[model samples]
Target: MENIISDATRRNWDRLSASTDGKLTSRANKQKSLKKIIPVEYLLDTAKIKLIEKICESYIGYSIPEIIYSIAVILLQSEGICERQSVQDILLDFQKENSIDLIQIDEAIPRFSHNEDFLGALYQSLLSEGDKNKNGSYYTPRKIVNDMLSEFDLREGQCFLDPCCGSGAFLMGVSTKDPSSLFGIEKDPIAVFIAKLNLILLYKDIDFIPQILCGDFLQDEVFFGKKSSFDYIATNPPWGNKTKIVSNLIDSKESFVHFFVKSYNLLKNRGKINFLFPESILNVKSHKVIREFIILNQDLNEIHQYSSSFTGVVTNFISMKFIKGIKTSVIKVRNKNEEFYVEYTAFQHTENKVFSLLKPQEEKIIEKVLSKSAYSLSSSEWALGIVTGNNKEKLKSSDGPNLEKIYTGKEIDKFRLREAKNYIHYDRDSFQQVARDEIYRAKEKLVYKFVSNKLMFAYDDTSSLFLNSANILIPNVPGMSTKTVLAFLNSSLYQFLYEKLFGELKVLKGNLMELPFPKIDSETNNTLTMLVEEIISEGKNNQKDIDEIIYNVYGL
Candidate 1:
């Protein structure tokens, strides 16, 4: 009997692990394929989604929230924790207006019932991407929840809260000795109901109610007088939400900024705040206000950057932790492959208070480069390329009457401009966004790619017009000629400096003004000009000699 039982158990495990192709899969590959647990995978599957959508279509009069409420009712009933009437009474606390008939899907209960936040997952999946982006609602994966929770050193009896909780993922991950200690505030009412239900299922034996509120964290009355209440706060605040809330703490339009400033107010002394944010929070110019607030106000503890992103979001993200106290002098940073520390003072020196995660050697190099700087491009004249609102109608590949060649970023190579491929009529009034006539018709100006990871400037004397992808820079350096300044801008040394200092893909005029221009003698300037002219006249990138000269000027 023992031998038979062992064989049967082995066969059952094999069956469970086999793929649709009848091949045994590795555990890692299987887990990766699922991306989530079994219950979540079931909800995300195509057949189940179609069934839910079909039911919604048939019940045309019912709304999505009402359908989701009915599903939650059935989920609770299947758990045997509460009867249908009891579940309905629990949902009433959320003030839901209507609910659909559960009897319509009576036979499908087994397929939908699971030990998970099934209703929340269904509602999120059903929502359009446009709506989700508008609200900045992206459900955090369980793996990320577990990873972020591991950072917090929790103690018994400490209260935890997730300010922008979506279906209680962070709250669910909080390992509190008392379930009631896990608190959350979410704006979505259906999500609030599901969060409470999930907590109740997790702690079925407990006799306490879950303190999950359904209201905006920024404008709700519940958060107005709740300063210094929570021992810990962890959340993924809405990204790029444009809802304006009046606060003098941080001046920004993004919703995440508003949520962050408010969360700081609600933390107890020595309490921690762990937030997952878009990578822009680290270095983007527009988000500088919050970075300043953090540097001036709180104890910035650590930053953990991740390469992975949410399902539809293209932006990479990072997680940061803060304590409610006087900020220390250094912040710990953890990347995928290494860990390091950056001085808090370094951010103060930067114009935007950007968090520059650099190695000690790289930081020293930047300091060395900036120390010998005598001038910057801030004195130069800058202009953007033309922005033809309707490019298809305005631009033509073939030439016609009054058509002029316009260069794009792809046509602007280092030290030389490639032949123009796009033709447009140079009508100043017809374009949506155009530079002044004199700027476009300059005798000699350097054009560079507006969106680039590195510098790609080309000297143009053809009085050329450029599309929006290219930008014009006419240098105003006192000691250097146009070609000499072009040499430094196109050199490899400046590329390294630009990438380390700004760390932005878009080459904005503000960032360009920060690049240091070392004062050079007339002889050195003339030598650089001759080298740049050689490369341009030959139409070849003779980068070696030109880069050497600029490297000597900066003493790199």
Candidate 2:
């Protein structure tokens, strides 16, 4: 379809919206509001004038919603497809509405038909964002759908499904010669109507007809009757944030996991399921159980992740594929042509932790360090700073008797601290969530940028308070002192290990706990402590001295 909508009938379609003056005001609002839950791509193309005319002939005097629904029912029934009893009941309810102005299908059909997705685009412009979020409905972009189709080679006569088929984009993307074997299941009545229309038109040129059932595919009935029903399934299920987990096995309460489990159960033994999911599934601690299940039971294929792939939504996205009954043995990773392959494995030993995957040499080096005496960074004394319930009310710019100098992540660098930008009015009876008050009052401590792109820690002997952004850490390692631990954290080798083990921009405590710290001898620890003193006294950014000491300590 062409991009531009010719001026001949744009006004009529625009005026069909709610605020516009019209005799069919209430009915127009219903159609406009219905647009939010229905994705634009799932709606059938309205550019075919002849197809529209033929469809309008049978619905000459029906209401807009009724006309569209009736037209779809006629097409599907003619192709020998049956509607569920519940859907048939919905059609019965549509017969009772007496539309104020019965649509003049002959006169308006031409205006509604355009060179683009005329009806879908028109509905999107008329609806609001709040309406779109009503049902956790988000239409997949064109390029994203294309990329998914490219990854799978659909063979003729293979049974396929879009379990949550919104407007049938996946079904339409499949250009297989046989549409008779294609299938889909959708719970939304409006979406089911639109999907049927899309498939009807898509298969109009061929002898094939698709079966898109209007029912929930996760029901026990579906499992018993339709188990192992398809060879391929592609869908973007609803991410119901407010929904609670019905099954206790899933650690997280997200609705996507339920959809994945249901879809997997319905697939053939060797079938593949491709989906677009929230990025949290890859590394979030809450999803560790599901991650283990997929890795152990399924042949995890590939993952393409990105931040903010959806224009209006703030969540990150990842595209992945899973082949049923296949366990991953060999894994490789690389970022080629902007595609990042997420591989969290190296050598024969690996952990189910975020960013644990490393390059060959990096794995060898970390293994060598672990082979010797060492401990996890968790053994160190660490405490998060005070989280002021209301920073504006509790924080003061000028120093007072009770106010203590505080620093944020921005005021700290490698082995040195910068000038204070703010101060916290500390009191025993203050409105602060003091997690570790003793750590806040300690005389000698090490502080690092709580939210840093890299490891940035500095030493402070004065008992200074810090904001939550600059967390405090005091080492309790038997052989290493506070200064030695600070040097190791700020060294180049530790920074490299950190980035390889956990690539998160924010240096969360979990990332710190995962770092493998080597137990250096007394001489090595003393040398690192002396280098730390030089870097702090001179206030220089040079890290070569400290880095060399860390390298020798690790025997790198």
Candidate 3:
């Protein structure tokens, strides 16, 4: 964790260190040193830069709280509130009570206008990426914080709390009439200290203590006296946190799920709870527990989808707002510039209670397609391609005496396969994961891309081996042949259904099993199969005919 500094943080620290030479121990020298530094882009950028540099060099081996205390003393001195002796007095009391060393900084600090959350930013920059991921603590951007805060209705004395708040981004963004109305709970002591400092800087003119505590929110029952104590709760909990939890309501070990359940338990009747989550929660099989809980218990008010918002993450994110104890039939969904309403019962009827935010016309098309279907691929045989654990050493690029052709996702297309570009020697003992011998050596099978936006299935009868990027499917439909199934899977109508119902980039088998396959007469099946063969023999010249026949057969 200590070796996972982000590139931006490293660059900022280096740039700041290169600008300073000797220690600036006097007020005159500190002010003069600041004037010689290069111009930066944002307010408080210089302060954050200097603070991070100091922490890395002087407090390298200290504990997190000890480092935080040093930062607090610097910030206090910069604000011209407390002298060095007063700071030492406060630290002596804290250390006497907690029995830990309170680090000292003798260097002179210059004053600056406290206009932003530079302390919070500095706290985030100092921590390594691995440490943040372990705690699921990525500070939310200020724009997103402000947007989520604007949706709430803050009366004069309404109570608001941000559970799992990191540096109090949401706490600082809320516009409550009274400063005391905001509360926060964080598990990291360093972040908790910075959060309290941020709120104090925000309301510097007032004289009140910030109610930010440091403890595990799930296990600590004494933080809130009773359930239903707050008017509103909003936060971006940790994602992909694999902490084990003991609960009768849900069996998921994901940290975000427990946070949601705990927050729901603490909300008052008719109170609102908003959360930002990864898009996979909508349809992933393992996450169905929380999805079912939401569908059966709470009423969803609105959902807004956003593109990738983090530095090194690629998954798209969405913000969902749920109201307690309110039952409604419709939910409002927004994506970019388009907005629409969907019946809440529509999700209830699905196999997994998936929240597929489709438009009204797309919903009608899906309903029309499923109504005429009588079969599915739930009974089919499925297998993943081989995982060699070391592909570079195991796979070969040229043909040899004992090597066989291996296909990847890049070699698969609609109704056909590109020329195989790699080969491998078959040995079950040398690989990490491989399907049964017969599944790969079947007389006929369908090979599809594992990670793709649209359906791309190819008919393969050559008994070829495939890499993990591709998967094997052998249909067991009652009356349809493998070719007929492949034609339906690669058709335009089915592609539309897959994209609308489950728009994930990865082609998961659970999602594939939920697709509908309508009953077709012998004549219709023969005609479709012939068109598929024509497209395979030629170069997709007869694809329109196959699409027309399938659409007409489904009565679309």
The candidate maximizing TM-score is 1
The local lDDT score (0 to 100) that residue 259 gets in candidate 1 is 85
Candidate 2: regions farther than 4 A off: 1-127, 206-209, 223-228, 306-308, 332-352, 355-373
lDDT at 476 for candidate 3? 79
The segments of candidate 1 whose C-alpha lies over 4 angstroms from its true place after superposition are: 1-62, 83-88, 92-96, 106-116, 223-228, 388-403, 424-433
Error of 2 at 253 (Å): 0.7
For residues 400-447, write the lDDT of model 2, one tens digit per residue: 786778787778877888988787777746755665667867877998
Query: Of models 2 and 3, which has the larger lDDT?
Result: 3
lDDT of 3 by residue, 1-556 (tens): 1243334434433443421121122333221222212112122355556655565567667765666666576777566554545344554554554566657765544443334565566566556544555567777766667667777767886888899988888888887757688889998866776777677666766656678778888777778454347888899898876466666546787778888888888788888888888888887767888888888884888887864344323256788888888887778888766788887655753577788777777778888888887999999999999999999998999999899999998999888999999999999999999999999999999999978988999988889999999999999776688888988898899888787777667788988898888888888878877887777787758777888888898777
Of 1 and 2, the candidate ahead on lDDT is 1
Q: How far is candidate 1 from the true structure (C-alpha RMSD, Å)?
A: 9.0
Q: RMSD of each candidate?
A: 9.0, 8.5, 8.3
The alpha-carbon root-mean-square deviation between model 2 and the true structure, to one decimal in Å, is 8.5
Return the clash pairs for model 1, or none.
none
**Ten contiguous residues minimizing lDDT sum, candidate 2:** 1-10
Model 3 residue 556 lDDT score: 78
The positional error of residue 201 in candidate 1, measured at the CA in angstroms, is: 0.9
User: What's the TM-score of each model vs. the native?
Assistant: 0.84, 0.77, 0.83
